[model samples]
Target: MSSVLFHSLRVKAIQPDTAEAVVVSFEVPQELREVFGFTQGQYLTLRKEIEGQDLRRSYSICAGVDDGELRVGVRKVKGGVFSNWINEHLQPGDTVNVMAPQGRFFVPIEAESKRHHVGIAGGSGITPILSIMKTVLAREPASRFTLIYGNRSLRSTMFKEEIEDLKDRYMTRLVLHHVFSDEHTDAPINMGLMDRGKIEAFLGTVVPAAGIDHAYICGPFQMNDEAEAALLAAGVPEEGVHVERFGIAQPAAGAGQVGAVVHEAKPGDAEQARITIIRDGLKREIQFYKDQPSILDCASAAGLEVPFSCTSGVCGTCRAKVMEGDVRMERNFALDRHEVAAGFVLTCQAHPMTERVVLSFDER
Candidate 1:
């Protein structure tokens, strides 16, 4: 089981969450249930082959830890191959390749705790926040949760009824706020995008930063940054603000010098970088053009499959540890400072900084 990075999961059902989003539930066999058992706020990497192209994406788990189901939310986007296929073609009984759960978007839940945790989410970003909200509310009875959800409109908001149900169940312990960018509400605060201004206003009023023990934010890169910044600026400790942001950003230039040894090639041709890939208890050497896309691409060209999804590097599915030599990731959003310091790099964004580098997916 440890050797398998992905398992074929049968779709148990598909429920439409909104016009463009759907909640997908997977049927995990009893034997594999333990393997699929996931912590709240984690995500699953789903893969499907369409039009002869292998498409892979990561979707956050929407179900709580005690939900007794493995589920994720998918929202269709323009030119999204996987999302469109999932929304239109996927049916019950269809099998999808799902990687083991991966994420660190949640904080510890203690039963005796009486803390207030606030969540700021946007559009489909509500998925993991919903999971965390439910888990925390149920696991820590004395704790309170405030969810500030942002969407274009009520019709486009995912998990509307489900969140309402949660509100009813946790009545006094849950605070729900819906902020819409399109629809106008009776209250002024509920209108407009959940940008930095709106979030700063929120931290000053409804869910005061001083009362907040922890803050969880998930949304577009800008919104996430704004919300996190607002929380931090309002006196919330840096560690108390947990954010799950998706997008690409340039990494700061490293101070250390990376060694490079040029291999003989044609004039104006690309240099070749040799990489030793260690996976499934086997070590194999493969060479790739330094000018090529990424190390993951080079590995795939060699017919080697480890684990990967969202080639853009937002998902941590392609994470691998550097065993020897060095590799540089152009940009990274999934790995933290500690993980990067420990030599973990997202293979999709990894470029060989040394002539010969060693990568280990086995260590994960």
Candidate 2:
């Protein structure tokens, strides 16, 4: 399970979306087929060494599972190292290291059913929704899909041309509405952001709120929050709205320094000291460091690989148990409070609060 072996994928192609965004398609090594199989909306964690420093980022799959080609779409953000590299420099036949597809942003589609699916995305959030929309329509012949995308302008729309083509192919079954915030059009509906009023009006006039079988949402933090609230208000069931939040962007290096004050631990106290890990029936001791890097970082540096994605703690890919020690986690956007209290830790965000910490990644 060492991550070192999974870090050798070669880049197949880099397709540009805009001046700042590029879609990097990678060839999955044949030996890692088991790890690359993915659902429609799952994402991949890409790690790379740049300027002698390791950087990690997550990008959502842009194609369906049956397509057999694993890909991710990334948008360059200001001051982002890996993203900027992919946008400006990454080319076909280059190499990039990526984790397997990982995320809880999708639901299984039944084999023989036509369903009504609605997706709301903003900016580059269309990445995962694009895959889901295509899969649902292609798999379920009678199914209908609707995508409401928001962008700053037509020039900035990530997949505007592709979406328009899908509309023509699917005829009336596939609906698309592009909301441009910083531009104007002859049609009133396309002139502004997809705000609460517009969404509510669409639900009232165009699509019935209760008729939606599934809904997918992805965007900036505020956009996601607003869209989820509007959908819930429109009578969509809580379970029907699947949200895919990008990992929270880390602030600039000097934005704020993390401070920690370690509590005292009793000597030889199992609860407060060293924790034991049983992997392949062999026991190993792991000592915790309250102020050090995450447990996953420590383990990986020690040559132990634990599968993970979005190390910013947005994806639940690195979930494991605290078999013996106490840990403190920060910014847990993926797991619920109950799971955290149930001895589960998102190892990517976990830091030792006690001396001994033990975890297992044997898939439950």
Candidate that would win on TM-score? 1
lDDT per residue as tens, model 2, 1-364: 3233345689888888786788788887787888888888988878888889877677889887777788888888777788888888788988877776777677787768878899999888999999998788778788899888899998988877778877888997898878889998887777777777767767887777889989898887667777888889989988788878774544568766222213343333234335455454455565545444677766666666566756767767788788766777765777656667788878877766666677765434
Residue pairs whose backbone atoms clash in candidate 2: 273-356, 274-356, 275-356
lDDT of 1 by residue, 237-263 (tens): 987888886554333477332212222
Estimate the TM-score for candidate 1.
0.89
Give me the overall lDDT of model 1: 0.86
lDDT, residue 186, model 1: 100
